[model samples]
Target: MAETVTPAVGDTPAPASTRRERTGWYVYDWANSAFQTTVITVFLGPFLTTVAELAAGCELGADSCAGYVYPLGIKVAAGSYYPYLISLSVFLTVFVLPVIGAVADRTTHKKRLLGAAAFTGAGATIAMAFVTGDRYLLGGALFLVANISFGAAIVVYNSFLPQLGGPDERDGISSRGWALGYLGGGLLLALNLAAITMLSEDDNPQRTLDLARWSIVSAGVWWAAFTLVPLRWLREHPTAAALAGGGGNVLTDGFRQLGRTLREIKAYPLTLFFLLAFLVYNDGIQTVITLASQYGTKELRLEQGNLIITILLVQFLAFGGALSLGALARRIGAWKTVLLSLVLWTAVIVAAFRLPAEAPLPFMALGAAIGLVLGGSQALSRSLFSQLIPTGKEGEYYGFYEISDKGTSWLGPLAFGLVFQLTNSYRVGLVSLLIFFVVGFLLLLAVPIRRAVVAAGNTPPRVL
Candidate 1:
């Protein structure tokens, strides 16, 4: 939510003064996305894999390591370390994210906490520059810290959505933030790629390694530096509910709040039901975003070079896509627009299942289609969800939102893998995901959105 909606309890009624702070909120998206695209989505895996392969005694640039390494008496594939570390981070984050969200609700310093999380994550990314000479463990350790902090930041950041504006404004605000994120992350990745290309002309192994490390460092710097905008301008948008005293240390209070939250959330069936719908569909969305490259490479026999280009295409186009979707939401309501996007998503999956091999142009067209609906769905999902949350529970509820989306997200991939294992058909594996879209869409329709919004004490948008 680029800013706010439904005018959080302490705010004036849709005042003009809030615009600057809202702009600052959008800048936060711009700042942090560098870390997301550069490190998480693109660079870190291959770099860490290279370093780990070296640690396992593989020659630089060799096709395979021909060995396994033991970490804590567990045998692991050298190429798997990066993904393993990411999974570990997400697993651990499943616990930490709720705590962060609960604390955000309890505290007046939500903005400060957002800052702290961003800086800590950025610091870890900066430290990644020293991950050299078979020190893949060090790199993994740093990323673990960074990834957890990133989740914390998102929870706190999302908590601000309700505090920023009114119902009619939220869809656009959230969509714009997402758009800036795409543009920012895309720009940074492009610049980093250009720098690496110029500096690594010879393709020397050590030079490439150093370039990769510095590129990560640059991403961290980008995150921290741009964060100053929000830190400087985003004022505390306090809730009307008084901050209740628990008479415990901050962490203890946070957990205490979380316990109460779990019990009380049952009162809001709308929130709970919306959350269920979000979890089901968002899982499918995340799976496609995660596995698209693998499907292109292994299933369609697309070139590695072409796959990279496709990723770039998705990143840049998603910016415009997000804005376009926001506009659509204003006209048709975010809920209905999202339902329409799901229809498109189902079509995209069916089309993907039938895409021909060695066809770069068709693959690019598919990517363009994915990019168009991707940002709109996510932005509006968050916008629509913000309405169902009760007053004073932004952090804790969004924590549930974040955790459900991130935690069980693996189910889609698991099902896809099982289908492929049984049928020996990548097309079947890919199309199997249609179940997630269909089921999630039906669940979403079952939500009774306006009734839920009214129950949650939120103003329904004009279109809705």
Candidate 2:
């Protein structure tokens, strides 16, 4: 059932006096990011590969035995299909998030929707424990559900930003949320890693497998536990009376509203341009996050412990970097800060391609550089987009924002996978990402920010 919120009558807005409540709301990121760090980005890929090989009836250390297997049904080169699976997941999210976002906007059930999505995601993540052997299908299925829920929940969460703050407070609030998320995510990831180390052996195959499963489960539990903060702290705004005119058919009306939004894009050119730029650059960023672990393990051949440590470093670094970039963005414009991030990303990708296999230190250095730029780029991008959205239509526009964020993500991974398949080289695949960075940077440079913000129905402030 949908939960209802009653907005306070007055000039100040619902979130104005609720500083402690807003802080609690921001903590949800910290609660949820553990899944991204430990399960999705770092540990899960390698762990799944190991599980697949075992399920294929292969013994450890046997020369002829399979060491890795694809979760997809493809028997010929399973590793190549992993990227495609990622693309497929993103494809599903692209179709689903906008509608969900629209529904939240028109309905009075934003918190209910968010809670449902969080539980769904967290449940799927926790269910990863039972996935073993040929159960790679089970793992993938759970991952698909969790990933979709996570993305959808984010839509609801982001929609709250406009409701929570006036224009003057939005960037700081958004940046603080990101920073807290990094800290929470990093802290939980550390605990999970410690549990794995204490409970399992480096060479004991069975125990190590158990440890991996535990790590995934911990992320789920952490996510569920931390989400309570936001669930309690954030309040949904009242649904408009106009949206209630359809009686019991409000959901249908919500869909109609979304269709209307799509038709109205011609009225907002800057929003259109920003969406395009966001789609392209965000794809590049996603590719980097998804592929870096595989690149470390398969291509660089770094030790597992070192790889884990590097990822941990990234979480902490990203926390610091996000705060730093927020400050930097205040000094130089947000657009320039974003441009700087793109330049750094291009250099990092190019450097990754050029790195020698024997020198793992360079790879670690590259990871740190990525950590510095990654959070800043994404956090600032979200804030920039927030500045462009209409006052009351944040949810509807952010629905489209999800489309831009996740829709063509397939392009980056598909490009990387295809390049790797054709050339049989990770270097070539790494180099290909440079194209996304360059193209996105060029396109972004051409966007007239002030005009775009105004066109999206935001009042044009003098400096921005």
Candidate 3:
């Protein structure tokens, strides 16, 4: 509810005020990724499935657990627990996050809002430790809160991009943040993997489950602790006084601004086209990240320790990949670099279908392939989009960007779940992602970055 200080037009600085503040902004990426890497990408899916099975009074080895009634008396199959929950959370968030983003744009203490959302999400994550056997409802409710907060916080975080740098610096800056994110997430994942391996007893599922629960709790702690740096250092830029025609009510002004912005967005056709392309491919990428460990656990019958290690490998390798792709973008351009990454993503999906169940070597190779492209594709996409946003509207525009990112996310997971339910095959479910990648690649090829920049009344990148 904080209002921004108004500054005269054309008075904003070229970049962040100091190296310290810039580092603080980057550290936020390091802070929040613990939840993304550990909870969303690796552990939570398998853990929630176990909880669902227990709730249904079924043993771990069963093909299907019947009579697992979710909250509100809805019956859910055990196999669909994680995917359906993710889909449900995304569906709910897509409706409200844009409004949250608009409000953040009007606030002077944007960093405070970001910190509040981060800690609130982290609290939900820490509470996951209490979700014991037959407590699936508790786990699902907590996950919904965490995911919603995560999405809202990201809207505020991304709005800081224009303040950090101009178009030329965006790729390196964005990629550096992503690399730091990998470092932070990877470091904690390694520690948790070591602890879980040491604590897990042979032939004891309960002990392994307990260790996994503690790992989730630790990620929450890491998120809250590291976020303090950004909260203390990142200064808020002045906002327009007549934001949405200068109404007294901030929320009313925010919605009015959002509507005007949506109407104006049509003038920049390439921006809309690029967003469509991003919407498609990002769906595939998000689906792969969220479902990878679940596939390893359920389809490949891999041990929990190995799946954790595989993703640990992914995190570090993705660190290098993010930096490497950023450097590559300097030579070729961010758009070209991202398009190339999409090619690799397409290959990764096709190869996924051919991977034999229980083969460590092939699985590890797939993990390596995924690690190589994962960070690069996402980092470049963000940088490229930052180049197209109009001046002084970062928060409102980023809300639309996030909507494209998370709103379409439900389609990929829903498709994966439905395919698995119908065919009883994870491979078939995975194949559905290929459609997203291929279509996205084709759409991206048509975007004119220079034209898009000019259309948005922004400077075009030198390379483009």
Per-model TM-score on C-alpha atoms: 0.85, 0.90, 0.93
Per-residue lDDT tens digits of candidate 3, residues 39-141? 8888888888888888877885454455354666777776677788888988887666777677777766688889888999999999998999889989999
Candidate 1, 195: how far from true, in Å? 1.4
- lDDT, candidate 3, at 73: 78
Which parts of model 2 have CA positions greater than 4 angstroms off?
A: 1-17, 53-76, 239-247, 404-408
Better of 1 and 3 by TM-score: 3
Give Cα distance to truth, residue 99, candidate 3, Å. 1.0
lDDT of each: 0.78, 0.75, 0.83
**Model 3 TM-score?**
0.93
Clashing pairs in 1: 2-173, 4-164, 4-165, 5-165, 5-166, 6-165, 6-166, 6-167, 7-165
Best by TM-score: 3
Where model 3 places Cα greater than 4 Å from the true spot, the runs are 1-13, 61-68, 241-247, 404-408
Show pairs that collide, candidate 3: none
**What's the CA RMSD for each of the models?**
4.1, 4.3, 4.0
Q: Which ten residues in a row have the lowest lDDT in candidate 3?
A: 2-11
By TM-score, the candidates rank as 3, 2, 1
